[model samples]
Target: MRRLLLFSGLVGALASCTTASESTTSTKPDRDPVAHSTIVECILYDGMTKTSPQLVTVTAGTEVQITDTVDYYFMKARVVKDGKTYSGYLQRQCFGK
Candidate 1:
């Protein structure tokens, strides 16, 4: 029957059209255990990143490790006082050149 043929054709067509999939996993490299690392001083930061709930402020000349520079204004750094790495945005230039 024509209906049976059409159904078979449709099934065949759908079977021929296979979907290929590719998987990828992204992992950030470790930039810690810095040796001879250049420390940066916090010049100005409005308590912390606006997104963070806890407001943390660092005084001038605070020792910090600039890990990943997200952009010209913000960078991922570790505050030496807390001993925990945090991603915070900096409002003013605070690092020593």
Candidate 2:
């Protein structure tokens, strides 16, 4: 019957569709550890982008706690200055191991 054929086609189509549980898992290379480090030279930005406003000029020898690694060039860092804690994105190259 046409109804039976339609039902089978619908079932076939449903089977061909991806399931909700089926997801793609992207595996990224392990990032180098950079938990705590000192600022050698750089400016801390309010955001991760280059166009973001500069929060502060991190002087050399300033201590920083890396909260997150955004990418190859930037990391979210926290610095304590004058009893105030500032959080922002800093250039990775500005920090020393």
Candidate 3:
């Protein structure tokens, strides 16, 4: 059930590619390097809160790139840690900045 729900959410996220792509492309090619952020604490990835299907426990101080903000608590972000890049929904409150 968890995997199914996560899969469905990912499909929904893909359907909104225009929005995600728009935000991703907003990054400046020149001066502005991709902003870096770290998970200030552990966060529960309920899957529904994020659009990604791959469910994994995000540990404290994990580095990531904010892809877009979905609301006050949820954000579309790319997890960049341990030599892996994962795109998903991360809680904004869990980040250090």
Candidate 4:
């Protein structure tokens, strides 16, 4: 009777351990869409003497809609206008691209 109880306890502990490990391993990481929207409304500049660039003063909570994915050191973005829009490229790090 003692041996049987010990064996059952061991089996239950092992089963729970295996279930916990399986749950952890089965989890998938969150994925971002290939093309998505982002809002970056700031200016960054690389100075001749500065090792890293600096972000210039920008309006607080400025929201500009970015309509594409970043695929280069610089990414092109368009500014919305009533009649026409202007497009330009900004450094990837500046906008977390």
What C-alpha lDDT values do all the predictions have? 0.53, 0.79, 0.64, 0.48
Question: Candidate 3 — which residues are off by over 4 angstroms?
Answer: 1-34, 44-54
User: Stretches of candidate 4 above 4 Å error?
Assistant: 23-40, 43-97
- Which number leads on TM-score? 2
Most accurate candidate by lDDT:
2
Assess the local accuracy of residue 48 in candidate 2 as a C-alpha lDDT between 0 and 100.
82
- lDDT by residue for model 2 over 28-70, one digit each (tens)? 6655434565557678899888799988887888778787888
Residue lDDT tens for model 1, 1-97:
9999999999887766653223244465766633123234343232345454543566665656665566666656555446654544554355544
Tens digit per residue, CA lDDT, model 3, 1-97:
9999999999998889967776745566454224555556544354535554554567776666665666888876666556766666777777664
lDDT of model 4 at position 22: 79
Ranking by lDDT: 2, 3, 1, 4
- lDDT of candidate 2? 0.79
Question: Where is model 1 poorest over a 10-residue stretch in terms of lDDT?
Answer: 35-44
> What ordering of candidates by TM-score runs from best to worst?
2, 3, 1, 4
Give the backbone clash total of model 4.
Answer: 0
TM-score of each: 0.39, 0.58, 0.47, 0.29
Evaluate model 3: give its TM-score.
Answer: 0.47
Model 2 residue 79 CA deviation (Å) reads: 0.7
Q: Which model is ahead, 1 or 2, in terms of TM-score?
A: 2
